[model samples]
Target chain A: MLYFILRRILMLVPVVIGLTVIMFAIARILPGDPVALAAGPNATPAEIEALSHEFGLDQPIWTQYFHYVGGLLHGDLGTSLLTRRPVAADIAAYLPATLELVCAAMLIAVAIGIPLGLATAVWRNRWPDYLSQVVAIGAISMPRFFLGLLLQLCFAMWLMWLPLGGRLPIIVIPPPTVTGFLTIDTLLAGDLHAFTMALRHLAMPAIAMSLSPLATIMRMMRASTIEVMGQDYVMTARALGLPRGKIILKYVARNAVSATLTVIGLYFGWLLGGTVLVETVFDWPGLGLYATKAIVSQDMMPVIGVALVIGLLFVLANLVIDLLYGVINPKVRYS
Target chain B: MTGPLLSIRDLHLTMTSFDGAAHVLNGIDLTVQRGEIWGLVGESGCGKSLTGLSISRLVPTPPATYRKGEIRFEGRDILKLPLREMQDLRGKRIGMIFQDPTTNLNPAYRVGEQLIDVALAAASHDPSVLGCPPGAGRRERRRAARRLAGEMLERVGIPDAGARLDNYPHEFSGGMRQRVLIAMALIGRPDLLIADEPTTALDVSVQAQILKLLKGTVADHDIGVILITHNLGVVAETCSHVAVMYAGNIVESGPVSNVIESPAHPYTRALMAAIPTKASKRGTLKGLGGTVPNLITPPPGCRFAPRCPLAIPACTAALPGAVDLGADHRAACIRLEALEHV
Candidate 1:
């Protein structure tokens, strides 16, 4: 197991290098000049030249790439032209909020999706199955941004049940930054009111982001469970007269969940970086929002940084999934 | 406790699909006693496996409906038992092994964990077996069950049983895995074991070993077994009694020797002739002509009439009753006396 993990981590070296290349290329290829964008239209050519020289933008593309790689080795992500702060530092500030939001969304997706999937499979062709199919299809078909808007209208505007958007209300003082996750920070500080507010603020955006992954998980789980249920082991379990619940939970679900877990892992990594629309709709201060602002202002460094981080996150999520497979299925040997 | 281990009387099962209701089991009767192994021999789609599933009430409903039957396990009508009561009887009082060892043991779990689960279940029904105290904690009971599981694996001839417990089902070879399944079924020490083609997926050499293991284990446990198989040779070697089924009906059933040596029913005789023996020359093996009749609209009388060369008009008029031939042998054929001329 240790060897497997080590090998997986070692394999990431090439992937990370490839990601850096792609991130660097994407930023360089986009039409527009970071120096020119930083210097307003009123600035003279001389001023633009000085700005370009100051940021090393005047160097050859290859030279700039080597310099970027050297700086990346030292954890220096360059400066965001718009924020006038280190790109890494800006990412550090925005990343935690995105992590919290994505984690919450995943929690919702798994907690609801798995049971719903199991229910649909066990009671296949019944009303529960039909209803779940409808729900899953509807959830998958609806666009995330559109779902976010609808949720905001129904729950935030019309019903006044949840907060409209953002990470917290302006009135409540923010919790101390312990884990950089507001809910966790608030709970650590023993501030119930702040934690409750944090959850309320989190509910809508997370739901919007979760719907598609939830549907994907539900469908995958349902299909996997149906297939596993037909297995001879499950029949043996039934013939042995293992209780219905035990048979479903241990024999059926344990085998069925492996495929769903893989889907969940892929979705988890995607959600971390792909929540641009949900974050935009909710006005949440996360990496997606930061990336969006950076793109609009043509701030290339942060864009590159965000892409690199998202790529790294995807790799890490898959590693975690591979490790989890060894735990869930004994047949999966590390060797 | 005084009655036979299991008895099925007039069992009629019909499976309703979009096409129509197919009469899967037509008025079947079977009796199994302690320490006796009964082989139910038939071709595919002949309802032998379904009969085994019906005994355990494992057949899925909606698609399968019991038209009429009484499955009495230990003098109690299991078909009439409440769902909860039926569950209690399963695994604890009645155990089962299935075909395709590759698919029968769950791939995700260790072989020992699966065995321990059955052990725990059996222990729950009767605490004295595992020697759990009156108020044993969960951990204590688990330890006991684990020990029992290892012991059971050793009993089934798995070498290094203690170490092998951690191995997953995929790690074991086909025959070894079948032995593991047999261990699991017998760990519960159920009175009846339903083995549905347990050795079908194994190699020819391994098939004999698995059958021997099954026979030996059931003998030691003193449990009745319903061995469902398509191979007549396996039945003759391993079973004390045999039932020949064709198109959802048992055509002939009696002492294995009596049935094998002198088959009264024409279908059974035809089946025996189909088997290639040392005396039978190449290309001389007689194959039973015609396909198994479709159960949806089965013929009015004897199901094998269409395929029976000796079939007469009287055979199609009504289903034949079982005619006793001595030595506890019975065959459902009106032309039993006419077989002497052939």
Candidate 2:
């Protein structure tokens, strides 16, 4: 397993390097100048040139790429043109909110999706199976932004059951950041009231973001489960008179869930970066919303930084999933 | 002195498919005595394996339905038993080993873990069936179960039984895997064991070893066995009694010697003729023409009438009843008198 993980990590170096080159080239080809946008339209030509030189945009593209790569090696992600703050520090502040939301949403997805999938597989072609299929399809096809608003309107405005989206209540003082995750930090600070408020605020957006991925997970799980139910080992398990629960959990689930795990990891990494529309609808302050703002203002550094972070996250997630194969399946040996 | 361990009376099974209903098992009667091995011989798709599966109710339903019959184990009606009791009966009172050893064991689990799972199931069954006290402590029970699994592997001739506990199913060779399967089936000390083509997926040398192991185990443990296979050679070597099946019906059955030497049914005679003996090795061995009839629309009367060389006009009218040939020998055929006289 150590060898597998090491090889995976070693393979990632070239990939990350390749991604950096693409991000750099893509950012440059976009029809906007961050230096010009920062200098303002009314600024003198000399002042514009000065700002460009300061930002290293005046240098050749390759020279700029080398300079940026050198800073990146030391963990500096350059400065945001809009905020003028270090991009890495900015990402750190915004990432935790997105992390919390995506984690909660993924939790919701796995918790509901797996059982739904199992039931559908067992009761295949029955009314319940058809009903669940319709629900899964609806969830997958429904637009995330529209779903977000609909949830907000129902739960907050009409039912008055949950809070409108935000990280926490403005009137309440947030707990000091230890992990930067609001829910965990609040609990760590012994602020139960704040934690409860955080959960209520998180409810709407999390549900909105979870639906599509939940459908995807359920579909994958259902397919894998149905495929496994026909396997000879399951027949052997049944022939052995293994209790239904053990047969489903041990023999069937272990084999069936491996395929679902890969999808879950992929969706989780995607959720980290792809919650742009969901974040905007809920007015939730996270990396998605931050990236949106950065792109609009032509802040190339932060946008590039977000892409690099998200790409790295995707690769790491897939690596972790590959490692999980050895854990779930005894046949999968690291060597 | 004692009644047969298992008796099937006029067992009929039909399978419903998209095309039509298939009469897969046609009024079959079979009895297996304790401390005896019964071989069910037939070509592929003859429903021999299905019959074995039906005994334990392991055949998949939705497609399969029992038309009429009573399966009696120890004089209690198995068909009448509730599903939960039936589940308890499987692997505790009755165990089954399937044809393909490559697929029968769960690939993701270590052989020992699967064995322990069976041991655990056996341990939880009624104490009388288990033949021991339920034992004390969960930890002690688990350890005991593990030890028993190791012992069973050793019994089946797997080398380094204790050390091989952690090996996955894929690690074992085909023959070794079959041994693991045999070990699993017999580990519960089941009253009856059903082995479906247990040696078909193995090489010739391994096939002999498995047959020997099965013969020894049945004899030593006094457990009844229903060994389903297509090989007449295997049946003749290991079985005490043989039932020759054709198109879902047992055409002829008796003591192995009687069935082999004085086979009453034409299908049985044809099957024997197809085998390559030392005398017939250089010559063109006789082959049975025509395929096993499609069960969905099987010809009326004896399923084998179309393929039977000795088939008479009356054979096509209705299925024949089992004719008494004496000494526990019987054959289902319309021309029993004519054939006997000849």
DockQ in order: 0.74, 0.65
Q: In candidate 1 chain B, what residue range of length 10 has the lowest lDDT sum? A: B121-130
Q: Where's the lowest-lDDT run of ten residues in candidate 2 chain A?
A: A325-334
How would you encode candidate 2's per-residue C-alpha lDDT over B1-342 as one tens digit per residue? 378899999989999999899998998899999888999999998899989988888887778988899899988888888889988888888999999999989888899999988888877885433344555677767778888899999999999999898899999999999999999988878899999999999999999999999999988999999999999999999999999888888999989999999988888888988999788857687899988899999998998999887788889899998988988899999877677766
Look at candidate 2 and give me any clashing residue pairs. none
Off by over 4 Å in 2: B128-135, B281-285, B336-342
CA lDDT for candidate 2: 0.88
- Scored on chain A only, each candidate's TM-score is 0.97, 0.96
Which 10 residues in a row give candidate 2 chain B its minimum summed lDDT?
B126-135
True contacts kept of 2: 0.58
Error of 1 at B186 (Å): 1.6
Best by TM-score: 2
Tens-place lDDT per residue, model 1, A226-333, is: 999988888888777677888898889988998789999999998988889999999999999999999998888888889888888888899999888878887785
